[model samples]
Target: MNTPYKNAKLHDCRDAFTATLEALAGQNSDIVAVCNDSVGSSKLGNFREQFPERLINVGIAEQNMVGVGAGLANGGKIPFVCAAAPFLTGRALEQIKADVAYSQTNVKLVGISSGMAYGELGPTHHSIEDFAWIRALPNVPVIAPADRAETAAAIRWAAQYEGGCFLRLSRVGVPDLLPDDHVFELGKANMLRDGHDVTLIANGVLTHRAMIAAALLEARGISARVLNMASVRPIDEAAIIDAAHATGAIVTCEEHTIFGGLGSAVAEVVVDHAPVPMTRLGVPGVFAHTASANTLLDDFGMAPDAIAQSAEALIGRKG
Candidate 1:
């Protein structure tokens, strides 16, 4: 496995998201979009042009946007609540918990420009804590799709899913790792590469990075397994357990904070079922500085080389 996707084309997941939503809207009259004045950032211009009346823009009001999404779902309309991730989850978390999750509404919460996608906007706009925030609620599935294919698949799944769910999407361009026909299933992890020395787990934009890291480890004669753990909440516990037992070491890399996110979720599973040597790479516990998403990620030691190094070190500690 020496980098099969070296020449893969880069794509913005937002394009796949909006395109998929527009297609779904054409078929389902009940499908609607609610936003917090984020039409451009959410890339809903075409959607608005096609279905003007269905696009509800609650100007700059995050709480009201969530409330309206819930109201629409109650009125037999499927609402995809689109907004910036920080405000969508942080400012209106109460509405998300009370109106959607607790009430069990069929609201599709699409957090656009999540993670450090807001790059230069600093920590105020960064949605690093979203996975932790939404995953703590009941009746909701938290997902961060890895590529364009996965993003479209997850959006299609959300449209049909009964209960409330959060779909965290990054604006950063990423290569298509999953196949076009890949179907997204809830709470399951996709094993991209298999090995026996160590396991590399990640999601969202970090999945491909993990693959690159696996290739780096392979070059150094270390067999590394790579897992795309997109479904964060009901994570693939079985996959995590198997990787732990098989590889004896685990390294989780995410665009989120080290606490209460992808790393924490994997660690929870490992500590519960099979204890293993692990390393969690992320923001570690601080507000990220003003920089591009990838720059901040590399600065925080999430680069492929850093990930490979962490995997090598963790493998050494596996007693």
Candidate 2:
């Protein structure tokens, strides 16, 4: 299946995130926004203006911010902890494990500017390892919304869901992938296009690229299926197996490192159920040099053309 979504108007997922959050906060006073001096980045200024007291700015302390979120959850208040992805996962991994995951608190851990959205800032600011870090812990459903619609839907879902969850969002603009009435279903994959020759799976900013890659594959006389996989932790194993069995080959892409990100998660499911020729496209276990997000993606062979080429190669290995 090939769709012309790349040319659609782009949207920043954070806008949808804040708008949905503010609307939800209006109905539920228990909702709160917790951040580490990231009001501007997280787009929580409007949220702060609407509900000043409910917005908790912990200021520079990532660990303390997460701990505070856990405390708020304990006090019967729903806390949406927001911060840069690297600091959120790298700096507060212990607190996330002890106060949230282990305690099973009803806190929404929102990792803003995830993946290479902070591109050009340098590798230290990049959050390529967040998926690996957060997914290693149990009881936390890791998710990355593909577009603004999905972001808002996921935020709404997180508000209603109990316990803890990691909502990985990016500042990069993406065209609307899912429909406006799209409802988020955890552990379920959205089939953007149906094909039987091969499967192209991706999440976050890479999803649009995957769609474009599917189009490119179609131009070359290949039937490429496209899947937008948002939930990384509780991935759609059934869809993965079906794709593997039907397609006989797979190409997985992500904005995170290939070592333990979306590609790795899908590959795990494929090997266990229906082993097939697979190619994982991402930062191949190396700290990326300073460059724009799109440049880095192309450099790592995650650009649409590169992805399409890799899919063709993977399909060649199919027996």
Candidate 3:
């Protein structure tokens, strides 16, 4: 509720992610790191250094890497399968579905550099479709953390959780949105700021952007509430209902496509529980052009000003 983080310095969530994983690994001997030749990119260097034998690198073979992770889990080891999101979800999807999801393995699938984090490298590296692909599966719990604190908390949760889960993490630096001691609750949305005019919902890199959009709306004399809806699959439906009935207008933002990502998930809840005017902001149904991550976000009308404008327009439809 405090605004001390209004101008907070930015942090890359991967730092907190690996640090927490390492700390948990120290306590649980069964915890291990697995990767598809992405130890550095996945920020697992310290993990490899501390547990060299435990770091399994499959040399660019994502399918084999996921299979090995399943095998480790079957062998009673808690494997943290790490890789770039695009390849992890795209290349090894079948393996993930069969070995991890269908079998209900205890492998923690960590998708690093998710969404548009590799923005300059273009769409092939962009992981915009991961949420849709993974969330469609039966068993995996889909999650994306807003900042370093949430990333740490989610990692801790995954370590304790019994089945497979996808952790969507980005390399883009963001200011702290949650407290250091924040606890991760599965399928629960965190209300960052409260208001009455409209509600802005988002996760991952977009959560901070939503907060800024809420502030922009405030400056325009529109009271905006912000919700960090991190878990996409088992979404916080109760929060979505509260937002729809309380605010009457809702705006959902994400780093993924508007088709099947965070926005669509929230829309399903809003339409089912309480009909409300809504605006979904993200990459449209098109391949993103070459640019930096922030540039791509701005191009897709997800910048704070753009989100605020969308919310303002949607408020007109609230009846």
Whose lDDT is greatest here?
A: 1
TM-score for each candidate, following the candidate numbering: 0.98, 0.98, 0.97
Compose the digit string of candidate 3's lDDT tens values, residues 74-184: 999999999999999999999999999999999899999999999999999999999889989988999999999999999999999999999999999899889999999
Tell me the whole-model lDDT of each prediction, alpha carbons only: 0.94, 0.93, 0.93
Clashes in predicted model 3: 0
User: Whole-model lDDT, candidate 2?
Assistant: 0.93
lDDT for each residue of candidate 2 in 102-166, tens digit (9 for 90 to 100): 99999899999988888899788899999998899998999999999999999999999998999
Candidate 1 total steric clashes: 0
Tens-place lDDT digits, model 1, residues 36-116: 889999999999999999999999999999999999999999999999999999999999999999999999999999999
Q: Each candidate: RMSD to true structure?
A: 1.6, 1.6, 2.2
Off by over 4 Å in 3: 1-7
Comparing candidate 1 with candidate 2, which one achieves the higher lDDT? 1
What stretches of model 2 exceed 4 Å from their correct place? 1-6
Assess candidate 3 and give its lDDT: 0.93
